[model samples]
Target: MTNASLTDAQLARSIALEAGALLQAIRARGDASGKALGDIGDREANTLIVARLREARPDDFILSEEALDDQARCAASRVWIVDPLDGTREYAEGIDDWAVHIGLAIDGRPRIGSVAVPARGAVHTTDDVHLPLPAAANPPRMVVSRSRAPEIAKTVALAMGTPMIAMGSAGAKAMAVVDGRAEIYLHDGGQYEWDNCAPAAVALASGLHASRIDGSPLVYNCADPLLPDLLICRPELAETVLAAIARAR
Candidate 1:
């Protein structure tokens, strides 16, 4: 296929799907598990994603977890931020919460993105048909880390009396808000641009509110790329969620 003809969104989705499939195949072979499996998945998938994006849009810059950060990307207006394998721990342990994130940040904002949750048989993208999310729970349902639920997240949940759901991967947690399985995904411990760029793009496009926990815009393609926190929730709940987070801090 001639990728030059594809739009930015389509290219991102295609790349994400291909990378996700490759990861699935590697896992299915089962020659390795744990760190071995994760290593292969991360390496091969990053190679595939980087090569495809570079081939399709050579002028655009890329920021990937596995690849060395080309500091030059900070000067480019269009940058692709990627997490070849989010939730490596879950993936290593044979969990399905892992994902591949492909996001294009334009003018420092996530303008297009696609997240491939291969195990879930889903690829969420900015091009998706928007649907009305299920009615959010009254107190709201918050998605948190399976192992270390952030103290800030727990505090917000308690303040709002929200029900918490444990999950792996920042992309999956953010997508939970998009999928309507949960209304809020408040993260505080830490994260990078790749960790949430695609998820943020999808969430924002899906009509959910996405931003820093402090309610600032989620910028990307920075020189450092150390965006440590974010908040994604229903638009109506953004205010309430931000308020709770403020009080919690």
Candidate 2:
């Protein structure tokens, strides 16, 4: 499709959906599991996404989780940040917390993006706000990594007197806030640009609040893709969550 015919948001969603399908197909074969499954899925999805992006937007730069980091993206004004198979371990283990991400960052900020949960057959994107965020649960719910819940997250949960919901994948946790499955997704554990760019764009589009844990705006396409922390939560909770994070730190 021509560039004028497809907006950046549309491209993001299409790429994420296609990548998700590729990952699901790989898993459906049941030939691999654990690390093997994750490795194959990551490589296959990355290849498919990179190839499609190169064909569709030859001029645009791309930064993918599974691909070699190219500092050249720093010189481009527009960069597509992607996570072909987010939560690879979850995906390999047949868990539903994995996701596919496609995001466009313009001027170092996520301008449009999509996050697809193939297992759930759901694709949340800046292009379409199809799901109304569910009403915040009583006392609110904070989502975190199942295996490595951050200490700050626990501190915030305790401060807010809310339950901490552990899940896999940065995209899944971020989308959980958008889907109303959880009211907060705060991560201080290490992460890269590809891990949260799409999710941040979708979250911002859905009217939720997304930013660094310190309340700074998320900037992408940097010399280093290692993003140390992120916060995606209901808008109403931004003040409270940020305050809690500060106190905990």
Which number leads on lDDT? 1
lDDT of 2 by residue, 76-105 (tens): 999999999989889988899999999999
- Compared with the true structure, model 1 gives a TM-score of 0.98
Q: How good is model 2 by TM-score?
A: 0.96
Candidate 2: list runs displaced more than 4 Å: 1-4, 130-133
Model 1 lDDT at residue 18: 99
TM-score leader: 1
Q: Estimate each model's TM-score.
A: 0.98, 0.96
Over 1-249, each residue of candidate 1 has an lDDT whose tens digit, in order, gives 688779999999999999999999999998999899999999999999999998999999999999998898888999999999999999999999999999999999999999989999988999999988888888799999998999999899998899999999998888888998999998885699999999999998999999999999999998888999989999999998899888878
Cα shift from native, residue 27, model 1 (Å):
0.5
Candidate 1: the clashing residue pairs are none
Instruction: List pairs with backbone clashes in candidate 2.
Output: none
lDDT of 1: 0.93
Q: What C-alpha lDDT values do all the predictions have? A: 0.93, 0.90
